[model samples]
Target: MGHDHAHGAGGNRRRLGVALAIIAVVLVAEVVGAAVSGSLALLADAGHVASDIVGLVVALVASTIALRPATDRHTFGFQRVEVLGALVNGAILVVVAVGVAIEGVRRLLAPEETHVAGLPLLVVAAGGLLANVAALLVLRGGDRQSLNLRGAYLEAMGDLLGSAAAVIAGVVILTTGFAPADAIASLVVAALILPRAAALIRDVVRVLTESAPRDTDVEQIRAHLLDTPGVVAVHDVHVWAITSSAPVFTAHVECDPEVFEEGRTGPLLDELGECLQGHFDVTHSTFQLEPAGHVDRGESSHR
Candidate 1:
């Protein structure tokens, strides 16, 4: 809670600007290269670059909104904006991969005119790889804090990998005069993209569904609280991720009436908060204090 989010937002914005510029330049280069060379690999790499461009633009927009001050309507502010952008980005990558697969399948079914020039595609792929690698480094930490950043990084990395695959495929096509190599590389890129898209979808679902933080155990948290002094029992415990990285929890704590009648719950709550923060790494929490026996013996975790 004490961390200054402004620092992170500023960093993200700076990185986003750099990433967008890199993608734009490489994307333009790809279009020219693909048009001139008429190479399937170049076209595929260009398609991957197009995805990177969108992802970077998304990152830029998300970063700008992420820095906005919280409003009553949006108590969590625009942090979730980054997550939305990430989800969109990941989904777009899936679309791109599928599009590429369709093209590859079409080519496999009915072969078309393709100018396989190893040197031309190689030159374009090398430049693309260099730019995308730099973009990847710029977006690394952004992914750690923001979903938008993760999407952007993945797309950029996909461009890098796709370009590498295209280069190798181009070399083989040029050497052996076999056009299928290009389709093979495109298929491989498509396969690679499916798992990454699936993972991003899973992460987004977990966060939005209020699923438990991956590392925390609800029973373990309940036991920790029940062990605290003056605690009669603990119930209605819940722990879940607000985002991939942030966690929030809520619970109802039963306390000894004798001690509560003495108004000693303040210190207890403070101690409990500290314990959870230190031991469980639960950052945001709310607990409804209950007098012993005020609630039923069994309780369920909710919201």
Candidate 2:
């Protein structure tokens, strides 16, 4: 009646750990550069990097917790902790972006009051860019398969763009003596962060709300089940995700009475399970097979 598929946390903890180390080094460098050069762009980038460190830490801890085996009290185990960790990472990004944007705008309005040392800012930003590039590569391999990894990847990407912007701002200030370029670069960093943060939060909300994965089509699955040879109808079909990689499904499958009478129900169930696993990528599934004449006393209410 049901099948269980094991989904591991993958190599995400190692990826997060490596990314954390790379970003921590960058954060310290950026903070010192921001102080010495008096560059708001560097300062904003430092703050963002600080948040990235926190996000990576949360993701690392969550990925570790997710490996716990299922118990009687928690059938799904702690896999959803990764989603909750991603939510925290997303929230941190939003806060950092808003704060950076506010400070950027104020600095833009008073460019004359800003004093930035171009050469040091440029040197430090270029180094930060390289570090971010390395971090991105480390996190890239698993980002698409895991929400927790994707959250960390997005933050690394934000750092990459922010560092590039700071580099450009430094060049402009060094060549044209335009101090407002630093503020503009900080604004650009904020712009790059917000959309990605929103997307991550949106996905986290979908998982938390028990919504079907974006790529799954419930009607298509119903049609597939109905098209099977012995299946007369399908009802009470439900599909949702425990995490990005873990999907759960359940349905009541009305079958031909002859299928049961002839002892063919086992083969029919096997076919249905294969269809779901092969076509829908739904590894965890439960089917309540019944003859056409079967009646569900009170359970039919929802169906």
Residue-wise C-alpha lDDT for candidate 2, range 1-303, written one tens digit per residue? 112322347478888999999999999999998888776667767888898898899999998888787899988888888899899999988998898899889988887778888898899999999999999999987888788889999989988998999899999989998888988888888988999999999999999899889999999999999999989988887888989888899999999989989999889989999999999998889999988867787678645
lDDT of 1 by residue, 158-263 (tens): 7877887877876787688777777777888888887887787777777777778666888888888889998887777777764555678888888888767898
Q: How far is candidate 2 from the true structure (C-alpha RMSD, Å)?
A: 2.3
Backbone clashes per model, in order? Answer: 0, 0
Task: State the weakest 10-residue window (summed lDDT) of model 1.
Answer: 294-303
How far residue 5's Cα lies from its native spot in candidate 1, in Å, is: 3.3
lDDT of 1 at 267: 90
Candidate 1 lDDT (Cα, 0 to 1): 0.78
Return the clash pairs for model 1, or none: none
lDDT of 1 at 184: 77
lDDT of 1 at 136: 85
Index of the highest-TM-score prediction: 2
